[model samples]
Target: MARTTTPLTNTQVKQSKPTDKRQKLSDGGGLQLWISPNGSKSWMLDYIHPITKKRLSMSFGIYPAVSLADARKKRAEAKELIANGIDPKEHREDQSRLQELTNSHTLQTVASDWFEIKKSKVAETTSKSLWRNFDKHLFPKLGHRPIDKFNPKRSSALKLSFDIGI
Candidate 1:
């Protein structure tokens, strides 16, 4: 494999003692820095389950493939989720769901599409009346207003009651 950016010197690997515990390379938290016999440094993080006390580790990917800063960020997120009694994997799923929902749409886009679909079924006279009423009354009052609003927008001269507000 190509060399990673984890900062291990070939000579330094020969001088270090080995222990069962994972070693921290820098003062930075959660980065378990290890020097191999061939002088390659690898990083890992261990997380223990609170209820079961079982230890598990998830890679943030290899050093150069996943930079130190990004690995630390991943670690922090994992820790926060764990602290909240949430599984990091589940938290990741939730984040993905939020992103998908956020990417989907605006109310206006959906409403306009529905309007187009419904418009095709109407008679010309009815359509004309709809357009006239809509443009002169409905469109002016409601078109540019917040799409989230269910209540009709009221101009000063005409006030109409609504079942709900936006």
Candidate 2:
């Protein structure tokens, strides 16, 4: 049988059958979202992790639950995470959770995330130096430890950023 592409629109997604099976939506890099016959729509992330050297596949929740705009945003965030040597899904969930995203959080946690955020923009030497410093001075003594456990001084955050060129 000749093959053709079917755009996975909300309308089309609503009409999908559980038996519809895997259907090709796009092939030139933008081929992630696909709908099953049962009308279940999911976003598939195609990226490779630098450290693991393995391809990453991620789901952006159900279609209706996660709007198209939100899905695209997640895809972008995932790509940014990959660029920074951090797994977006795991790291965000593990460290930068929404509840902890706002102010009034640990300076150390925020600082670590800041490092991850800036990993892509800085030079390799800078990035390595920052981590090396942190690992040697803080990590072995108080690193890999939870945020609240340390009660990091609030003023310390500002000092840390300036020291690391963050």
Candidate 3:
């Protein structure tokens, strides 16, 4: 197979040293390793926004942590997204937001966190009553649900429970 000129070799990447000014080493297909003045290196892709037709960059990860091969793979994936008319930067942001949403504390998680905090500040009897109230009233209906989805105005269950004094 004929050797490509653009993709950088491991030796070339390993030999790269940072200078006073930052340097960018192209590994072909828009994958590049940016060497900072402090010798820290990170992988990024330089691409054009699919919709806006503007130049943009997105970081993959740090060098060593994100090797040249890994960077190339990331670049290929970005290229695929671009070909599909999706900007990689925006796609990345959307993925990040989705991850954040999924990982955010649910009602149960927030209640537990609040309980821990309050336990440290309040009397033991008050803490026990709070826990009893949560276990009886909140956890059965809303604990598993994310806090964002809980609308007080729309919850008939809450109104019923309040009327019954449970």
Candidate 4:
């Protein structure tokens, strides 16, 4: 028969003392609070990776900051993802990748890409003039803004001079 473990309480967690070695206090369902020898506490969830079938552990957050209730909620979400045939770690990685891509695809970045393609095809003088125009007119307002939020009509230089070649 499998042994059953008792869940932890707020008082127990609060009163937990640091020992010479690191200790893990189980809150059940693969959720546990890890106490380091230095008394630093953090939350962790242990689960079998859906694809690899290997035991994996994910850190929820530092204790007190994460709180017991919040850790349980995160555990439930990870469990749900596992049940849905999704790997929680992979899902998190995918979301981070999307966020990074969104952050990188700014107006300045798009403009730089256009400059690169045009650079090889145009004369050096024209290239420098084109970049100078972008720096003088459009970049000041829209350089840092993401492409999705950029409005062409807001900049007369972009709409008339660049778009229509005026």
Per-residue lDDT tens digits for candidate 1, residues 48-162, read 7655767765555655566556667787888887888877755677988976665444334544565577568877776566556556765555555444444335443123312
lDDT of 4 by residue, 40-82 (tens): 9999999999988999999999989999999999999999999
What are the lDDT scores of the predictions, listed in order?
0.56, 0.64, 0.84, 0.88
Estimate the TM-score for candidate 2.
Answer: 0.45
| TM-score (all chains, Cα) for each model | 0.41, 0.45, 0.64, 0.76
Q: In candidate 2, where is summed lDDT lowest over 10 consecutive residues? A: 22-31
Question: What lDDT tens digits, residue by residue, belong to model 3 across residues 73-121?
Answer: 8889999999999988888899989878865767788778867987988
Please provide, for model 2 over 1-166, each residue's C-alpha lDDT reduced to its tens digit, 9 standing for 90 to 100: 5356454455654554555476534322333666667666677766676688888766767767886667767777777777788876687677656555443455456567878988789899988997787767765655544455443355474467567556
Backbone collision tally, model 4: 0
- TM for candidate 3 is 0.64
Candidate 3: regions farther than 4 A off: 1-5, 105-166
lDDT of 3: 0.84
Candidate 3, 5: how far from true, in Å? 4.1
Clashing pairs in 1: none
